[model samples]
Target: MLIPYGTYNDDIRADIRAFGELLDKQAEAEAWIKQFDEKAASAREKIKTAVKDGETVGIYELRSQEFYVLGDNWGRGGQVIYNALKLTPPPAVKEVVDANTPPKLISQEVLPQFAADHMFVTTYETKQEDKDKFFGNAVYKNLPAVKNNHIYEMTFEQMYYYDPLAIEGQLDLVVEQLLAHQAK
Candidate 1:
């Protein structure tokens, strides 16, 4: 199940409830509500269409196998992948493994195998040196991703800690790197 790890405001929930109420055929305003739903659906489709054009998108995270489904507001990485898939000439997407997952923690492994084809690592400043040291060592040299030089690193502050408004900027960097290194 997809879980939202962030805050949820009452106003958003209220808005959603109100929208649902409008869907009731028994309501006297059903006709207008239907029109609204149609319009809203059309707008959503437009956004999806825009995404299909190679627009850089961002979300919090993604599930292991279903890249298209996204968590409400917390799946920043998932949003980006969904958008990429909507593209006419879709950009290559790599599944984002949760850093806190047991398997990922135990073996320091990213999953789905294909994700390793173009892996990106983002970490805090305090951990950057250690991460760099470890990945730079000979032991890391034997890993498939590292051996092929497919792993790229970026700062967590740049990718995740900054203002939410900056997520698109981070995604631009990710898209560029993925496009450049996709085949290699």
Candidate 2:
């Protein structure tokens, strides 16, 4: 089974075990997949409602070539925080993928179609450099989040670890940033 990223725990182990059991049962496997889809849709609704009444957030990953959006199904810490805060992610990212699978890379051509009030960028290296690149780009300057200076930098390694301590740390960082931005 393909997952976007790794989350080491018994729950994943159990999923693996179940995957093995359902391997030969095509109907069962498809049924399980359906369940995942339903759950993801439900999560998106809850987040949307939250964003309607709470804060607006956009979770993004910057790669060398393409922009990636962290959607409701990624199972990353950003998704967790977004869900908790009831913040809806960019709706353009409609695909519901497994938590372990990588998000779809969006083309630069469609950049204008995406918008958010506040942006969280996942920086893999040189956080300032990544932030600087985004800030310097003319294509992104018109974005409300960028125009309002609401862009935030973070690292996936710091935010995506599925450990309890890691989640707590990510939660604190996400909430702190949101609160800070909301105040302004």
Candidate 3:
């Protein structure tokens, strides 16, 4: 079973079921599916509890002066990633995500105005020098999130999948980082 990169929650479950069918393990597949569903639900509820108000979140793979939303591989973008985690970006972030397709290129200058509340930077195959250079730029430095130190790190190796297992880990990371940020 070949699954496309742009798949959402149920689509992935369907993929799992398909794979199970292919392997003639329907019962096992159903069990795994139930586990995944429960995991997602638990994460969603925990996230809602952690974040009372919605926040504008920017998940990026920064390259030069341009950065792609979601991830560089275009695996999960727009509402797909959020939907998997059951998290919602504020209107500021949602508008752009809804308007543009996955792996949307958001120039450094413009993105800050849209979603400067929280940012997740992907460092997969990205040079430390380039990241440091971007960090020094006035545009990056001036962002409210930057000043407030609301920046967090994610890896393409992990987040690119956006599968049930990946999202379980992703939700934990998000909650941990957000709670830590709130504490500060």
Candidate 4:
């Protein structure tokens, strides 16, 4: 069972192997992360105030049907909108997760236990047909975002980068889509 990067296969044996000392060293890194959590949390509160309170936002990686949350103990460029908008991210799961990791993949055969008020589906491919197939898949079509018609397609270039400019772009795109969805 070879699970590709950025994708998880439930049928495959879980890779729960230990990282030993490297894992232990993360404690020092976590301390640094804690310093910025305050700012991110504050930004989140303001974003929530602007939008309907308690509405969740999630970015669904279309290539693998995985959901990207603010993983680990740090905030990254890709999560700026979610933090600024204070959208409720998927509930944090307690596990040994690495930073900047790919999302938690949900099997295509199973309905996601989590849903979002606005779901952004992103992929590296540019073809609409490819996107259509992914979004049209059974489990994806049944997601609350798809069912509510709040699903928005985002290109890989728009959502995949983590540099300052890319972060700004992602934030802008998110605002535009969310506003459009709100209008609809």
Best by lDDT: 3
Error of 4 at 122 (Å): 0.4
Give per-residue CA lDDT, model 1, range 82-164, as digits (tens): 33232221121212222211112212232232333334454433344565565555644665556655565555465452222
Angstrom error of the Cα, residue 176, model 3: value is 2.5
* Winning candidate number (TM-score): 3
Q: What are the lDDT scores of the predictions, listed in order?
A: 0.37, 0.57, 0.62, 0.50
Better of 1 and 2 by TM-score: 2
Model 2 quality (TM-score): 0.60
TM-score of each: 0.42, 0.60, 0.74, 0.57
In the range 39-98, model 4's lDDT, one tens digit per residue, is 456544544433566665666554533434333222232345444344555443222122
Model 1 RMSD, rounded to 1 decimal: 10.6
Ranking by lDDT: 3, 2, 4, 1
Question: How do the residues 119-169 of candidate 2 rate in per-residue lDDT, one tens digit apiece?
Answer: 777755445666577657888787777777677777677766654345446
Candidate that beats the other on TM-score, 1 or 4, i.e. the better one = 4
Q: Predictions ranked by TM-score, top down?
A: 3, 2, 4, 1
Residue pairs clashing in model 2 are 3-100, 3-101, 4-100, 4-101, 5-100
What TM-score, to 2 decimals, does candidate 3 have? 0.74
- For every model shown, the clashing-pair count is 10, 5, 0, 0
Residue 48 displacement in candidate 4 (angstroms): 5.7
